[model samples]
Target: MPKIALAQIDTVLGDKQKNLSHIKDYCRKAASNQANIICFPELVTTGYSLDILGTELWTFSELRGGETDQLLSSLSTKFDLTIICGFIERGGSLGEIYNSSGVWVPGGKSWKGTFRKIHLVDSERNWFSSGTNIPVFDTPMCKIGIMICHDAGFPEIARILTLSGADILFLPAAWCIHYKDVWNINCASRALENGIHLVAVNRCGKEEKINFFGDSQLISPRGKPLTSTLGDDEGLVFGYVDFNLQAKTRLELPYLRGRRKDLYNIDHSLIV
Candidate 1:
């Protein structure tokens, strides 16, 4: 059994230090609970306020292996745990910013993998460039995949990850207040259909203009909610992820094992 935690915390828009401190505190708490891994919400260091901040946030875009990388590496080593947190990424070209995640592993001083959010939505199109690929990272314990907020709506992404050998998917999101019902259904559907344990960490509380709904959940492979937090509050929630149970659930469900590659291919030429 692997113990993991989700930090469903409130973030201050454009305040990097304050937000990082909040995540670090929860990392400590999760470490105390003997958790193997801990995750933070999307844009954990900066609130989901790109519409307001605009290009003003470019300075916060961390270059790969920048200051944030060092800090997260230290935290991972200090806690002896793996850390998955989202951050704004700075690309090589001018005005090239990405909504990305930095994954830090314990006993290591570098990022295990970095994931850029693939689907940009609404106002995000104007601020950040979308990612081209989904990368699954390997930890000493298990393989994990990361998905951002809007990506959760796409079942294809979850299916791809499961096919690529990811048993656990970590979704760090800052979902708004109105789409609660849709979010609930999407999460359950993804886990059940793909046969993977999902660790979805959503933000809580309201920023100046955005009201986030905090219903952070750690769902099992069978779509069972192991532990969850409801309402807008800043705190940490714990859950268990059993590799044996996950394997058993996949066997029982047969969604992955029963896929027929011969009949699953879609032909676009006939759709005229």
Candidate 2:
């Protein structure tokens, strides 16, 4: 089993430096707690709900290895920790913008993995391009994958990660008030179906006009809520995952092996 912690920080809208500093402070605390991996909420470096369509916030966005990436790279090395966080990525070779998440480790020249968001919410469709691939990275404790907010709503993303050898899925989200129940149900279902540990870090507090539901949660492979916290507070949510449990559950249940792909073209539907 490996212990992981989420630094559920309350980010100010459009403030990158303050958010980064706050994240570093939280990571230090996680290190003291001996967490093997530490995660932050979606758009953690720059506040979520920024007007990506407008010029005022556009200046805050960066390329994959821009200023924010360098800062994360430096912090990962300085703290000697495996760090995962969310940022609004700009200027990719494939597109103009992407809602992205990244994973970095100490002494690593490049990031362990990066995931551009595959799903988009209302208004988001206008601002960013969706990613085509679901990728995973091998870490010392387990195989890890990254997802951002809306990606969790789609079950195929979870299946892709699991099939790609992801033992643990790290979700960085800014779950708004209207979709709190959706977040709860979707995360649990993803964990149970894939037989993989899920660590979901969601933002707290209101940003712009959106009211966020701050139930940052960690769910076990068996669909159990291991630990959860709610409403506009900033702190760490910790959980320990046993990779052996995933193997045991999948073997016992045999759900993935007995799928009825022959009966229907599930992939034809937007979300099957």
Candidate 3:
């Protein structure tokens, strides 16, 4: 069994140092609680006000192994726990920036893996470039997958990761209060449909006009919430991932095993 801590905290737009300080505090708390892994909300480093950021979004974006990455690496090493948090990534190409999440393991020099947000929302497109590949990171505890905010709505992403042997999925989001229902449904649906444990953490607070509702939670393979945080507040929610329970639930449901792959083709011409 692995214990995961979800850090549901508010972010100060465009303030990396302040946000990093907050994250460090949470890491210390999670480590004290003996949590093996701790996850933070999307863009925890830079915050989630893209429209307000405007052209200055580039100023906050950093290349792989940059300042934020170094800090996360140091934190993981110091805490002796894996840290997963979202940040703005500066792509290789000029002017290319992405909304990305980095997974840092204790004693590792660099990120274990980085998952860029593949499904960028409307406002996000203006500031961030979408990622193409779906990567599942291998850790000592278990194989882990990451999906940022909007990506959770797409069942295909979760299924693909599950097929790739991801034991658990971490969703770091900045979902707004307006679509709280969608957030709840998507989180539960993805876990239930894939028969995998999911840890969804959303930022809480108002960034510009958007109010992020932090109903951050950990859901079982059966789609039941094992633990959760209430309202839009800054707090930590802890949960355990029991492999035995996940294995049993997958065996009972068999959704992946029963998929009719041959019938589900992407060719539009086949549609009637």
Which candidate achieves the best lDDT against the true structure? 3
lDDT (Cα atoms) of all candidates against the true structure: 0.87, 0.81, 0.92
Best-to-worst order by TM-score is: 3, 1, 2
User: What's model 2's TM-score?
Assistant: 0.91
Tens-place lDDT per residue, model 2, 115-143, is 88888878777777787878898776778
User: RMSD to the native, candidate 3?
Assistant: 1.4
**Lowest lDDT block of 10, candidate 2:** 49-58
Per-residue lDDT for 1-272 in model 3, tens only? 99999999999998889999999999999999999999999998988878888888888988767888888899999988899999988887569899999999999888887999999889888878889989999876888999999999999899999999899999999999989999999999999999999999999999888899999999999999999576788989999999999989989999988989899878888789
Clashes in predicted model 3: 0
Deviation from native of the Cα of residue 19 in model 1, angstroms? 1.0
Flag the better candidate by lDDT, 1 or 2: 1
TM-score: which candidate is best?
3
lDDT of 1 by residue, 148-207 (tens): 989999998899988999869999998998898887888888999987889989999998
lDDT of 3 at 175: 94
